[model samples]
Each structure stands twice: as structure tokens, then as C-alpha cells.
Target: MTARCSMRLEERSARHIDFTGREDRPVQIHLRDIKRTPGPPNPAGLDHDMSPPPRLQQVPTSPLLSAFSAHRSETLSAGRALFVEGDSGSDIHLLESGLIALSHIQPNGKRMIASFVVGNGVFSLSHDGMRLLTAEALQECRLRRVHRVELSHLPADQAEAVKAALDREPWDIQAETLMHLHKDADEGISYFLVRLAGRLNGPISRGSRVRLDMSRVDIADHLGLTVETVCRGLKRLRSDRVIDAAGPHNVIILEPDQLKRRAGLGPDFD
Candidate 1:
């Protein structure tokens, strides 16, 4: 792409999106800035983003946000880093929709997948005294972010309210991923897909299709697996008669119950 951006972090307090080739005004943008390039139906790389980043649209408007005058929004492309660990924590996103892989990059450059946050998940939440981790888009993602100043003003109960919204998703299989420092590629990949199917749609639908919104490579990167292994897991599930590839991005579930059993959930969860 034609849009040139140097790597630097700047603060913003504006009402409009930072589009129109402006210098950094809390606006939204594509991952690589390929403006003229024509995108495809699924545009393998094209983001399924809103026009000017996602608006502050999630329900239960954050009382914390009341302290801030402006907000920043952006759409993240799959596989792109949202924020690397150790970077100064500034803002947090109110994810509209999509799979977000939170992983860690080692000094040796090896990566370890941590968690795949979906739906109304918040990316920055410190609990029991732990710092932030890395976050990246596992698929075309739309997000609205508010600055830390806003967080600082969160009323005790209101702040707790926002935190409660993020918690409650039961920390079982996926929560165990936080401690991983090294990559377990294979097992990690399996756990990720299981969580994805478990998170977005319910488990495999007895005799229906399941759509995989994120790509294999993003899945691999998020799960610490090679692309090949991610594909293998999908094939393995199909072989077991648990699921079927319905189309490029869809999978049919022959036995949703079986898939739930693997994801640490009961068949009667509904």
C-alpha cells in the first residue's frame, strides 16, 4: 500500500476517524494500507471492518468512558499485532466481533498462543496482579478503544461492572494457556479450534455446518502450531465424523455433542 506510516505512538482527542490520509488523529485504518487494491468476496486478506473503525457500540455503555472526551477505533487484519507485550499499556478495545488471538513472542522470536477472545471480550484486564499480554486479530476484526485516562476514572462499581462483563466466561481450557512460555504447537492448535467452535457458535451442531471465521495461518499463529498441523486438526475432526467442511469458511457438524465433550462442556449446556 500507498499509505505510509512510521512506527510511533501518538495520543488522540478527536471526533472524526483518522482517515483522509491524516497524520494520526485517533482514526481507523487497514492493516497494510492497500487502498487501490481490489478486495475479494472474502478477500483472503481484506478486513471485514466497519467503514471508520467500529463505533463505541457495545451495550451497557462504559461509565468509565464518561471521563474521556474522544475515542479511537480500528479494524485489525488477521495475523497483525494489536499490541506486543511489554509495550506501555494505553488503551483497551471494546471488540465488536471476531476472533482475537492473544499470544506472546519470545526473545528468540518463537511465539506461543495464549487465548482467543471473541464477542464482547475486552483485551486489557489485570487481575490477581498480572500484567498485559500480546493481542492480534485472528480474523478481520472491528474494535473501539478508549484511553487509560478513561479507565482511571471508572467508578468503583462501574469499573467493576466492565470487568465483570469480561470475566464470567468460565476459565477452564483456554485460561490454562496463560502460563505457556514455549510453544506446544499441536496440542495448542487443537485447544484453539475447540475454543473457537465453543465460543462463537455453540459446539458442533449434531448434523449441521460450522463456519470457521479465522484462517488456518492465524489459527496456527494463535495456537503455536504450524499451518499444516492446524489443517490436520480440522481433517481429524472430519474423519471422526464430528464435522465437515461445508465450504471455504464453513464446517458442518455431524455431532455437536461429541465436539462439546472435547471442549470441556456438557451436551446439555443449552
Candidate 2:
């Protein structure tokens, strides 16, 4: 590039010297108009001669996940793939609102969703995307994707948590924490619901039946259970008067203590 710069300067200098030698009468050469050769290419080192016209780059955005910068942020409609398996990881994503389904597509094109992350969900965040899964927004949503290279350094606690979450599938999260006297999708779903109820309200009481914040399909995906199984499990609970469905997104706890017992008793819990 420096060689190219020097040649350009030489060409311009030769032209300036021959100014009066033209066929026209003597013309005042505005000496000020002779621009000095630009100092060693500006820090960007871009070749001015061959560079393409610059487009309006999307805003210099920041990642909601943390301090990282994002190059793109937009509202994605349902069924949009944020990332695909085996693809190189260039960015980490954060779903500020709405839900996203994470799935693994089998060789036969069957999709087995591992989880459905809702508002404040994070994705594609491993150092190299070791746990590869395809993320698709299940509903209209807003997302932010930041270049991984730009976020090499992060604070201690957040960095550790995000890294661990990236290394393992979402199922591993509940599996590691919940003791399974009879570990299975059924029991996992029970535990998940009971916990969610407690989180949203309090310990199971007369009105303690948990109302799922997500849909039945979302719950099934998170627990590795089939949709039918999830529905049956909920129905079983309902028959036992543990809960009553107020509507699609609403449920009333009928027997909180019994529901907790059905989840299996623990001395620590008692």
C-alpha cells in the first residue's frame, strides 16, 4: 500500500510541475489547491483508490447479554433460524423479549427441541459454540447478536455463568440440580412446574398450584418430553385436584401440599 501511495504522489507532482506548459495562456496556479501527499495511510490503512463506496452501517450496537458490541439487532418473525449446526460461531445472542426454540435436527429432518428460551434468554454463547443447537424464534421477537471476538474479556461472575450455560444443553441445567428418585421426563416436568410455582408465588399452599409461564409445547421441549406426555401429566395433576386450568395461560392451585408431595418429598424441603 505504501508503494502505491508513493507512485500516486509522484504522478501528482509531475502534473503540478507542467502546469504552465499547457497550450492555454499563463493561468494562475492556486498553489494552495495542491494538496500535500496524505501522511502514511490513516490508522484504518484502507486503500483509498480501490475501496468501495461505504454504506450506512447499522448502528454500533451493544449486546444485552453483557458489555459486548453487536453488529445487528432486529425483530425476527417466527421460524427464523438464528444459527445452524456445524456453522462457525461469530456471535452470541440475547433475546430481550418473546420466546425462541432450540432444537437439533436429525439426519431425517426431524426436529427435537431441547428447550424454549423465553424473555431474557441467551444463546450461541460458548467460546467456540461447543454445544451446537439451532435457535429459532417461536414468536415475533427482538434479538441482539454480538461478535464473539469483540467480547473476549468479561467480568468474573457473569462470564463464568454464561460460559457454563453455553457448554451444556438446557436439560443439563435442571438435571444437575434436581435429584431424580425416578429421573424421567415426567418427574422432571413435575419438579420444574413445582419450582416455577414456588418462584412465581410461594411454597405450595391451598392456592399453590403452579401456573406455567410457558406453553405446553415449550415445557415439553425443556423437559425432553413429548407434547402428549406433557398434556397427560397436566391432566393427571388436574384430576387429582392439584390444579385447575383457568385458561390456556392460567391455572389455579387446588392442593399445593399434595402437589408438592406428588413431586416427591425431601427432608430439606420439609
Candidate 3:
């Protein structure tokens, strides 16, 4: 299943979905910025964090992208939907830059965040042909969309590049499943923070402060916990000197090794 995103207080119905957002001009970035980074063959971290100040990597550039000339990039303002549930699945997106949240709304009106997408990640509608989740920008973002029709005609190597990108989606679902097995909310929260920290390394090292781009509510939804529970978990971590919530959105991982243990991550994952 493809992960998607949503964050709104409005009463939502499948019949009516909105894409309203704050005023922000479309940003244009060159295709050279659309690099490909390999995701772990197995789900390596907790909920995949896509926060800024990224952990830059060296991965092969998708030569397939050079073949396309007609597609144009578009800017997605913060809180805007790149595509809503039930929208046409005409294209799959390549996140050029910035963070995006993937979420799903249950029939009872509760929302569950699927995962987060950082730069170079790919997201699309559900595979069955209609959009199944809502993908919303957590911050101002720019992305390139390749039409599904265009994808079908690509040569083998180019097609493989796209497939490799899409392979990361299943790993997220698996990670989410693994998180729930522990049954401890604090452990789950630790797992979540550790994953975010892994992606957004600090200037000096991985132990530095990590800026959380998503809100407490988003974290709660992704972990299947309540906002209050999420708050308490952070508070507990703070009390133990495991982490420091420096501000509403900034967190400093005081003990990286201990944090991994709390998340049930072994030395191999570390």
C-alpha cells in the first residue's frame, strides 16, 4: 500500500475533500535536484522521518528521468494536498525537496498518519487505480510527477529505477507493524524520534538536536496513540535524560545509544 498524508480539523467525508492552502508561489527546481537514494531493503528504522537538514547520501541518479522532457515541477504549499483520496491516479510524484506527510482517515473519522516523505522519496495513489490516501505537504515543497502512462512505456532500466523507489513503501508498512508488537507507547515514541534523527543529522554528528517538522498530533496518529499519550511519552523520555524537548518542535537526543535500546533496535540497526 502506498503511504499518503493529511492534517485538518474539518469534518471529512469521502465525497468532499478540499485542497486549500496559504499563499505561496510555485517553486521551480532543475531535474538535477531529483536524485535517487536507496531505501533499506528491510525496514531499517522506526516511522521514516523526512525532516529537513537531511542526511545526504550518494546514490545512483535515475537515468530514466533524463528521458522525459514534458513534465514540469510544481510547488506544494504547506498544508496543501498534492492529491486527495479518490483523485485520479494519473501520476506518481518524486519529492524534489521538503517534507510531506502520508495519512489515512478511518471510517469513524479518526486519522492515522502512514509515514513521512523527504526529498528524493516517491509517493503515489493506491495501486488499485484510485487514490486511497491523502498526501499533504508538511512544509513548502517542490516535486515532479510522472504520468502513469509515461511510466508504462519506459525501457527496462528506467522502469527498474522507478520500481526500486516504490519498493520503500512496503518497508514503511512493515516497520509500523513491528512498532506495534512492543505494546509500549514510550518505546514506540522513542523509535519514532530515533528514525527522524537518523534522517536529519546534526552539524557535528547524529547526537545533535533534531528538528521535528510534524506536530505531536501527527506523531500520535502515526503511532496509533493519542496526543496526550504522545506528550507524556516525550515527558517521560525527558525525565529520564533520554531526550530533551528543547522547544515545541525541536528535540535533542541526549543519549543516542540508549534511545536505540528504548526503541528495541539492536546493535546492527545502530
lDDT for predicted candidate 2 compared with the true structure: 0.52
Candidate 1 ranges beyond 4 A from true positions? 1-72, 77-79, 125-131, 152-158, 165-174, 178-191, 202-204, 207-209, 262-270
Candidate 1, residue 267: Cα displacement in angstroms equals 3.5
- Report how far residue 237 has shifted in candidate 1, in Å: 1.9
Best by lDDT: 3
- Mind giving the per-residue lDDT tens digits that candidate 2 earns over 88-173? 56466667666666666666644555556666556772335553765655555777655565455665654565565556645564
Better of 2 and 3 by lDDT: 3
> What residue runs in model 3 are displaced by over 4 Å at the alpha carbon?
1-71, 152-156, 202-206
1-270 per-residue lDDT for model 3 (tens digits): 543333222222211111121223433211101112334322111122244433673333566454232345566666555666665574677777788877676777666677888776777756667776777676778776777777767777777777666676767766776766665897888888877776666222344787876766667778889767777788778788877766566888788777778888764463
- On TM-score, the stronger of 2 and 3 is 3
Tell how far residue 186 is off in model 1, in angstroms: 8.5
Model 3 scores a TM of 0.69
lDDT of 1: 0.53
TM-score for each prediction? Answer: 0.60, 0.57, 0.69
Question: Candidate 2, residue 169: CA error in Å?
Answer: 6.5
The digit string of per-residue lDDT tens for model 1 on 1-270 reads 544222211222332211122233343322321112333433223333345634675444555333222444456765555665554554656676777766565667555556667776666643333436656665568676665455546668656655554464335425555623343544454445455666677644565554566555445565656656667666777677767766556776677667656545567744
lDDT value, residue 188 of candidate 3? 89
